[model samples]
Target: MPTPGFPPHTLDDEGSPIWLDELAAEDPNHTLHVVRGLDPAAALEVLGAKPQWFQACELPDARPDEWTSLPGAALGAEPGSSATLLAGRVGEWTFVYDDFGATDHDSTEALSADGRAAATSMFSINADASLTYAVDGKQLAWINVDDLDLAEDLPGMPAELRAAFTAAGVVEFDYLEPGDPDYAIAMRAACALAGLACTLDDLRRIPLLVTPLG
Candidate 1:
């Protein structure tokens, strides 16, 4: 069976959607956030999206590559200044994606005000990647893939979360080489524990709410 995770690591894994691979290849500099218990609109607000500019769009239309042609693409003060965010609810979690790492660690606390929130970032241009989680308005854990030795679970972290981390072999992350698929495996496990399992098809078929960063 294909390994369970975002961006399936297996070769010719028919079980996984093609979009996952497409996303990993086409957008190397982006962030994917999953927040429990919040709908698309609520998640967007928590992530600091500008409400007035919000609209519903399909994944292709909202792709960051196409933002240059979006209605408000030129509204920013400078030339070629535009930001786009796409969010949708999948199962119990709201998934948000942006071209850059817009959701920082501090904002994650607010994203989990009612439940939990998990974010995974990949910025190949800067060779940066990180995973962050929060629960009940409190930041619990943050791990930069390049520095796994510095990761430590917080006091209030849920038992299931710890188990998920272990199952994903997070402790071995330090030894893995750059561009390893295990990094994504660990991220998928963490988000899965929070009830956030998303396939690329979900993004393509679902009507995600779109907005600009305020």
Candidate 2:
């Protein structure tokens, strides 16, 4: 089984837990740049300094068959290398987006190996402040608090968050208790949405930010 924080046997290794905003704190002259949804110029605007170009930090290279089996097939670039706009992980499952605008290239495919395979779990914040869960780079579930009517459609949801939907008179489904399949995962999603700095295990160990009962 893959570990919770990092996968096993992937070519890339996990790095320290660094947030998106932390890149600016580091001296740009020394560290290589890793960005998401921003190009070098945009990154400079957001992070305040143009860091070095990115280079994939790969381990001893997985087999070709292993590379082809992942969700998004390693990586993807734009057609004719006009501009690179894609999302994937580098070493340590760090999410980064590289945009090479107006450059000519051969094909749209980027790297050969799935860099995201190293991530065992992750939470993404949607545009509307909703939350989604991804395990092993595959989306497991999502909860859109803005739309209460669509609660039943939420499959594999955790019990703690399900109450949020029910309280709003959205749906009345049996809730999963502590020992349920995705109970912990749901808790993490809820805490993340609430802007809590908690992990999968932290949900059980620490008090939630939103106070699900209140």
Candidate 3:
């Protein structure tokens, strides 16, 4: 069995953790971006947040309902705009979580500039999920977690990446049972590959800093 914080073992005989499933059920739509080599503050800045406007908050406090409930003026965002994120550092990587928001390709490329790397894992209410990895300012690979074939022919795909995909069971996503924790497993495995040891507990208890999405 792979270690708890590592791939394969992350989801054991019990399947995906209840918290992860509950989070997806509650939020339905969210995106998580992990940036290597940047602390939480610098990662938020790279994503276009002003230093003075930063808000210290927990991950739960940044949930869509909680955030949207606050007046736009309070968040320094346009009224009714769903453009906020909760970010924090886990080991050497900064994890940014956004509700109903996504970091575009340009932003990921920018975040990964100068020998750094970044990855985004997006989940939607419709059971759709995707992950993208970028390194040194270029998108290295992208894959729809539900469909591995979509990425089988990616040109210039690196061997290490393919290995990561394989180790994560992303390459065999099609074989998972209907109710398996495929999304969580694949996403966590990819994060592990980048040296991030994110767990459901981390997501729930981490001291996340908040800012409006850039």
Candidate 4:
């Protein structure tokens, strides 16, 4: 089993969290950039997992094997040629992204507090928010005000936040990174949609995994 050991990713200049807005500014010709963060199963390809699959992150609706290669685009660019790899660690989880392949990309976006995955188990939340957690997927776990014991699988959050969650009835809460699976992701999507922008201090962000709930 993959151990949870990824770390918080940061930017070189401002020391802020690595984000998409920065990645999108890579080139002038590259007007559209699509990214998505895959789950453990999806990440196996990069972690020495064999037999690969490809797709254009921008065209999720497109055929699975099809990719619209754009000239001067990073994906189509030569290997190691100005290829920007953004990433971080959160235990055994290594979250990363390059504007290259489609499936390895973190394109699953948030309707609000917009987000995507840079790599496995590490999701990037563009906005601040709250979340709910449950051990049963078929059942719905409402956002409660109690603290949750999330040491086993939920290894990303800080000890302080975990304590808060335990007291607040929250079993899940992280600064939703860009790589987390969409299943049970972004609980307050509507909140992000209602308001154009909300500061990190204003709302609650949570990273909920449905697998454990199931």
Candidate 3 accuracy as TM-score = 0.67
In Å, residue 133's CA in model 3 sits off its true spot by: 1.0
Clashing pairs in 2: 14-92, 15-92, 74-114
- Stretches off by above 4 angstroms in model 3 are 1-25, 59-81, 150-160, 170-181, 194-200, 203-206
Give one digit per residue, the lDDT tens place, for model 4 in 144-190.
Answer: 21232244424554342233222322112254233332211222121
What is the full ranking by lDDT, best candidate first?
Answer: 3, 1, 4, 2
RMSD (Cα, Å) of candidate 3? 5.5
Which 10-residue window of candidate 3 scores lowest in summed lDDT?
Answer: 65-74
lDDT tens digits, residues 76-190, model 1?
2122344456677767767776544555556677888865655444443365656677778877777666655424542344665555554443222455654343445434444
lDDT, residue 18, model 4: 27
What's the number of clashes in each of the models?
Answer: 0, 3, 0, 47
Query: Model 2, 159: alpha-carbon shift in Å?
Result: 6.9
Q: Provide C-alpha RMSD values for all models, in order.
A: 5.7, 18.2, 5.5, 16.2
User: What C-alpha lDDT, on a 0 to 100 scale, does residue 167 get in candidate 1?
Assistant: 40
How far does residue 170 in candidate 4 sit from its true spot (Å)? Answer: 19
Candidate 3 displacement at residue 123 in angstroms:
1.4
What shift in Å separates residue 195 of candidate 3 from its native position after superposition? 4.5
